[model samples]
Target: MKQDTPTPLQEADDSGFAVRVTQSAKSVAAKVLPVSSGATALLFGVVMFLVTFGMVMVFAASSVDSVRSEQNILSVVFRQGLFTFFGIPLMLIAARVKEGFYRRVAVWGVLLGIALQCLVFTPLGDEYGGNRNWIRFGDFVSIQPSEFVKLALAVWIGFVLSRKGGRVREFIPAWIPVAPVAILAIGLVMLGRDFGTVVIMVALVFGAMFIAGVKIRHLLAPLIVVSVVAVPIVLSSPSRVRRIQHFFDGCTEAEYYAGCWQQLHGTWAMSGGGVLGVGLGNSRAKWNWLPEADSDYIFAIIAEELGMIGAITVLLLYAVMTYAFIRIIREAQSPFTKIVTGAVMVWIVGQAFVNIAVVLGLLPVLGVPLPLVSAGGSQTLATLLAIGVVLALARSDRQSSQDGEAPEDVRLAVRAEGRA
Candidate 1:
């Protein structure tokens, strides 16, 4: 066959395809590249590593349970992976959103979060482990709305406090809409009886407020009120009371088979791992001896299988993440970015601390998952989305700095607003 030269139309078509491909490649590269600050890149990398490690751990920790429950061995990990698949893109999309967009939606986000949480009181509500905090779509799908509530509360607090400027130092101006709305969001979760989440939310609010420059004296009043309120709530539930007593007084012999089962097993798992762990996928605790082996107590599984080295490595990763958040907060031009980043830091890192502490028997069994390392879809997706918001803030600050506007100029503007 003779190879004929292309006609003008064919040549035009080929050129068009080549240009399209080039443009497409550039677009993809733009999305993939870390063209922002070092903090953004570091945060992204740390998150990805945690997520991947979590998936592996979830697989290892959940396999025996899956087999015992007569489900496919891959079922838990596959579900976790599926959420990660969706979450990573959601995170990227969130990172690309403008700060103005978050400000515009902050109030509405809080409202929507509250609405979703309220669904747990309706027929759609589902209960697990004594807390009614989930909305079930059917047998196959259920979501914990409190996870999204934490994000909304963080954004709302940042928006309100940032706008308040120097007024944040005053009581009425600082707490007015922010404190009330936050209380409502947290109270709804409290109604669900998930005190663990409530505790984290409290930390998030205080962290944001402190970062935004609220007076320490003002915080003390609320601190006392929260302490007073928490006591009654803790005493209201017999199970809660028992867990608290077990934490302070230590577990008795009869209680070991009852209320202290999870804690005792968790301690054993941690001790069994020694320094280097038994090796991945070799945890004896996951064989039904430990409750929530893949979620709340996943760190114990890490200890049992990966040992002290693996466990410490995970802690170091979180420490690195904390540093990234601090970098972003320090470099951000806007008060909102700093406040929001601080709130998210407290939420994720504080929750991780709480989870790890519970596993180590320093705290009671709180039923909180290990952030990105747990086998829970809602917790993972919500956490990734929060990180995306922080990334967006970091990139915005980076762009502002690169545009030749000095940090002093931004500070002067804020000071001018405060004077006004």
Candidate 2:
């Protein structure tokens, strides 16, 4: 049975369909292929590595607690994995979003963040470790609005400073709206009593401003003001005061069992790891010894199981990530990209530093988790989303260069303005 020949209309329709398919394939390739820039690829690889490593660590660290609570041994890690499952796609989707979209939604993003944060005060709010900074939806899910608030604050600050451009040196024009909005964001988190997040947000704002070329003299005044306000706030919390005192003064034998319990145990865990560590999944600290083994104090658990080498490996990964961020920032033609990337760098890397420092007793316990490596769903998702934004910025730079737009030296432009 021979098939009948196609009609002219049918031939025309088939040709059109083939052309459409070709166009679609080319479109997909264009989107997929350009994401392979050295910086973007390095960043994407490093983030995925940390995320996978985090899942392994979270399983190791939370297994004991999970079993003790009579839940499956994989319960905590499974939830973390679920977050990762959702987060990765969100990250990739975010990475493909255009720069103009971020600029257009910058203010609305802040407002949405603020609205979510305010929900923490309502009936849906849940308190954990003394910070009422979470919004819970029944027994299954809890959201930390502060985590996304950090992202919004970074984007908003970047937008504001970039818009100001040369006037970033002038305090009033640069800071009026930016300062109040940032302070409000930070103030909301503070009201939730999460001093750790507050500190990270402050550093994030400062980092963005510095990258946007705000003058040092202008920064100093805000630093003083924050310090002054911070002192009284620290003093008001007895727990905060004890933590500060413990850091400055030695922990007495009695105090060690009291206020310094977590810090002392964390230090012991790190030292116990010696060189190569006790071996993965062999952490003694996770056996009801160290509090927050899978979250804020996860680094100690990392040291205990993987040893100094493992701990250092984690640090090196962050260093590599920082390098990728710097590469993107340096290559970026837009002030907004530089500022956003810098702020995110500070938020992730700076928070990691704070978390590790707390573990090593270099600083008092600040209750901050290691970004992308902790068991917290909110933290992991937020960090991955932020990373996606950086990737988008890097891709934007590459696309700009490919279009033959001469790369502008953002720093040089800022310096020229300063000289003027």
Per candidate, the number of residue pairs that clash is 1, 1
**lDDT of every model, 2 decimals:** 0.90, 0.89
Question: Best-fitting candidate, measured by TM-score?
Answer: 1
Q: Encode model 1's per-residue lDDT on 193-275: one tens digit a residue.
A: 99999999999999999999999999999999999989989999999998988999886667888788999999999999999
319-385 per-residue lDDT for model 2 (tens digits): 9999988988888888878999999999999999999988888888789999999999999899989
Error at 308, model 2, angstroms = 1.1
Off by over 4 Å in 1: 1-30, 252-254, 404-420
List candidate 2 stretches off by more than 4 Å: 1-36, 405-420
- For lDDT, the strongest prediction is 1
Model 1: lowest-lDDT 10 consecutive positions? 404-413
Candidate 1, pairs of clashing residues: 277-307
Error of 1 at 69 (Å): 1.3
